[model samples]
Target chain A: MIRLEQVSVFFGPTIALDGLDTTIEPGITGLFGPNGSGKSTLLRVVAGLLAPNAGRVTFEGSPVATSDEGFVRRVGYAGHSAGLYSRLTVRENLELFAVLHGRVRPDLEPLLEQIGLAEHSATRAGVLSAGLKQRAAVARALVHSPDVLLLDEPYANLDDEAAALVSCAIQEWWTPQRIALVATHGAKKLKAFAHGGLILKRGRTVVQGSYRERPEAETFS
Target chain B: MSGVGFVAKTAALTRKDLRVEARSRDTLPPMLAFAFTVALVLAFTLPDATRASAKVVAGFLWITVLFAGLIGFARTFEVEREEGALDALLLVPLDRSGIFFSKAAANLVFLALVEVFLVPVFGLFFSLDLSSWLMLALVVVLVDIGFVAVGTLFASLASQTRSRELILPILALPVLVPAFIAGVELSADLFAGAGLDDIAARGWFGILLFFDAVFLVVGALGFEFAID
Candidate 1:
């Protein structure tokens, strides 16, 4: 379980996450918000990439800081920008992550196949198309089989087929032991997979419940 | 996921860097070309008498290496920044110091390769005997460590700025003055037939080592904050 208590984040004068409080259990939790709605900030904080100004974030009860190597090992984050080495081949990129995570014999072939990149595994990531690169990023994120996964706008630049691939991969990877937080703009797509979700407006949580109880269109507009 | 041991993580990171450089051929060739071009320009421009002096030649060679190395340093984190790879690396559970050491090692290798071409060309142009080549090689190795130690830290810091190309040299060169001076002085002593036993030569070597140690420790300690 992950908990954010009285969490507040600021960027200059802008409030990125405003006194936000929430708890997420083990499951797929879709983060629904429009632009600048703090979805990315929330994921970043949970991933230990950013620290909150006024509160604390805990993973299974321990505070998560960027410097906590032990805490970070169990968590995986893929941001809006696909964090990949452009000069490295898809296989090499995944292999590096696996090594870092201390996997002695990483099952790379399966991951490559799962992400629909087995054919392009040898290709340099710099030359891969946007959709394929996104898939590669997803594959890299899951290479270590982290207990906590945070993905921000994973399907932003993907084509329909690529998006489907990523969506299915996430579904296939999700389990009771792993907590996945997917921040996305696609409501209908997320509705199909997410058990529950939170809706944010202007850095505040406006709604929190099962996807079926999402606020009407007037509340969002 | 338990993280790998420190040595294993550092080796993996270094290998990744070398493999990327080996395939892309992006960093080393440009560094060598820049160094060689500067040497050629210096060869034609220097006065005939001044060009023959070992001190003058050593000074020019060190300058060429320093400026050429700036190119490598600038690109150190630029590659990571280009594709958001730095964030990926940071997300790993290994100590951030491992990232710093691995990058410094890789930069040292690139700089050393450039020196392989540089030393021979420098000797040929200056009409100097290669008798002191061993000592000179040691000087190059020590100096490269100092350079990369400080350079990698500043490179990571500069990568966060919008004007990274401008910010790297500005931030690195000022902090590197002591190392640069030590490198030039030590190289000059080596070229002038001073043995390692010579008091002045030993002093400069000590300075080089000291600078390397200090910058490496600082870089390792401060790297997490700089990137975070």
Candidate 2:
């Protein structure tokens, strides 16, 4: 589980997140919002990827990544960018990720197959279609089998089938031992895996409730 | 500290980068050709320097390396940015400095390889005798390290821009002039059989070593901010 206490993030004059306090539990937690509503900021804070101008983010009741090395191993964050090696093959890219995380050999074929990129394994990631590229991005993110998965706009270009694979990967990856937070606009389809939802607007959470609860209160407040 | 992990991470980055370079053979071949062409053109244009001095050879080598290294450094982060792998790199547990150093190390190795052919060609054309090949190698290594350290840092910043590739050299060239000057002058002195101690002064080589250390630390310290 992750916790944030009165966290605020500023990009120069622009305030991305304002004095926000929230707890993110295990399972897929949808950080739902409109454009520039600070959904991404909140997820970054919980993942320890961004430091708050004020306040703090903690994991397992301790400061996340108290050391730089500690954080690198503990959190897996996927930003809005695709973040793949365009010139390298999908398998090579995954192998590199695995090696970075201390795995001697990563069985990426399984993840590649899961993401429907098995045939494209030898192809340069840059040459793949957008949906396939997104799938490859997911494969890289999960290659290390991280504890907490933070995905920003993960389903942007995916077709229905690809989206399902991504959704299932996130769902299957979520348990008491691991957590995933997804920041997205087209998150209605994520209702099934999301144990709860945190609706952010104008840099603060307007509502925090279960997936079955109405997001209307959060959107309006 | 995960120093070993940091090394592993750095090696992974270097290997992946080199692999990508290998895949895109066209990307590097043009630069090699361009470097040799510059040397050949200079050789044909000049009267055979029956009296070619070490100073002349030193200047020739530095200019060639600068132009050639600039092209290579500019392209260092291009593949990653285009492929969308930069974000994936930032997501890992490695320190930002580790990323910077790995990139620097990779660039250093590459530029050194190019210099291998470049130096001898410069020597052959200029009719200069490199009395101490070992000393010449040291200066080359140090100078290139300094150049690539700062160059790698600047490349990352430029990689995010609208005119990514074209902008890297413009930004990097101005910042690297001091290091380049030191490298060229020091190597010239050494080639001319100047006092080892005198060459150590701006010994362009020594200056380059100093700059290498400084930039390595600066690049390491500033990497987190740059990548984010």
Candidate 3:
């Protein structure tokens, strides 16, 4: 479980994320907010990409800053950027990342197939369609077999087929032992996969509860 | 052992970068050819190819490597930035300097490889002897290390901006001038039969070594800021 205690992220005078506090546990959690509402910033904080000005972000009982590498190893992060090489083929891209993360498992080929990228494995990432590229981006994240998945606007640019593939992967990939936090404005379609949701308005958590209780509250303020 | 892990990670990253460059095809060959062609042109222009001339200045050769090295360094992080691999690399638990050292090592290797072809061609053009050139090679290594040490980090930062490759050399060259001058002067003095024991040559050598050390430390210290 990841805990954010009174966390605040500031960029000069503009407060990106105000004094925020939350406990993100195992299971799928959605961060819904309008543009510039700090959903990405909060997710970046959780992924250990950004440092909060005050307060602490901890995984389990240890401080996040103290065990960056140890904590980073546990997270599969897909930022708003596709975070992929357009020049290299899908297989080359995935292989490079797997090596970078030090995951030498022989099952990478199978995992690529599992992600439905088996056919496009040899296709250069730049040449692939938008949906295929996004799917490949997610695959790179999971290559390390991270226990925690932090995705920012993952569904962006993906078509229905690609979206379904990603959604299915997220569902199949999630477990009580693992956690997934996805930031998106479109949470309605994800209700089938996500168990709960968290809403942020102007850098503050406006709501945190199950989707069934308050489906209307999922929208940004 | 942790430092060793850092070194291994650095080597792996360097290899990965070289592999990427290799697949791209045009990156290294053009640099090798460019270096040799520059040497050939300099050779033909000299009064006599076998005898030292005004064009045979050691400063000029070091200057050549600096410019050529910048070409390779600029391209070093270009593809990675475009592809977003840098973010993925950052996400790894490796110390940030692991990224710097690995890149420096790889740049050193690529630059060294180009120089392997370049130095011989340079010697051929200038009518310089290989026996004396061996000492000059150490200066080349020092100059190249210092050049890429900071160049790689700047490349990473500048590759993201609107200027693209145009900005890296602009930022790198001014800082590189001192090291280049020191290296070139030191090598010229050594090649001119001034004993390595000469105080001026030794001072210049010390300056080049010191510059290399500074870049190495500064590169490691400032890499996180640059990458971030």
Least lDDT summed over 10 consecutive residues: which range in candidate 3 chain A?
Answer: A98-107
Highest lDDT scorer: 1
Ranking by TM-score: 1, 3, 2
Better of 2 and 3 by DockQ: 2
Candidate 3 regions exceeding 4 Å error are A10-15, A53-55, A65-67, A212-221, B1-5, B25-56, B156-178, B189-214
After aligning candidate 1 to the native by TM-score, how far in Å is the CA of A31 from where it should be? 0.5
Query: What DockQ does each candidate score versus the true complex, computed on alpha carbons?
Result: 0.68, 0.43, 0.35
DockQ for the candidate 3 complex? 0.35
lDDT of 2 by residue, A88-199 (tens): 8888888887887777756777777777889999988878888888878877778878888888878989988889989887876666778888887766667766777888
**What CAPRI grade goes to candidate 1?**
medium
lDDT of 2 by residue, B1-228 (tens): 223477887988888778878887744676688789998887877676546666676777788888888788877777677755665676676778888988998888788878898888887878666787888888888788788888899888887787856888888788788887877777777777777777665435556767888998998998677767
Candidate 2 lands at a TM-score of: 0.84
> Model 2 - which docking category?
acceptable
lDDT of 1 by residue, A1-221 (tens): 99999899999999999999999988888888889999999999998888898899999899987678888788888897778988888988998989988886677998888779999999999999988888888888898888888988888777777788888889888898789998988766666777778888888998877555654432322
Query: Least accurate stretch of 10 residues (summed lDDT) in model 1 chain A?
Result: A212-221
TM-score, candidate 1, is 0.94
* Model 1 TM-score (B-chain only): 0.94
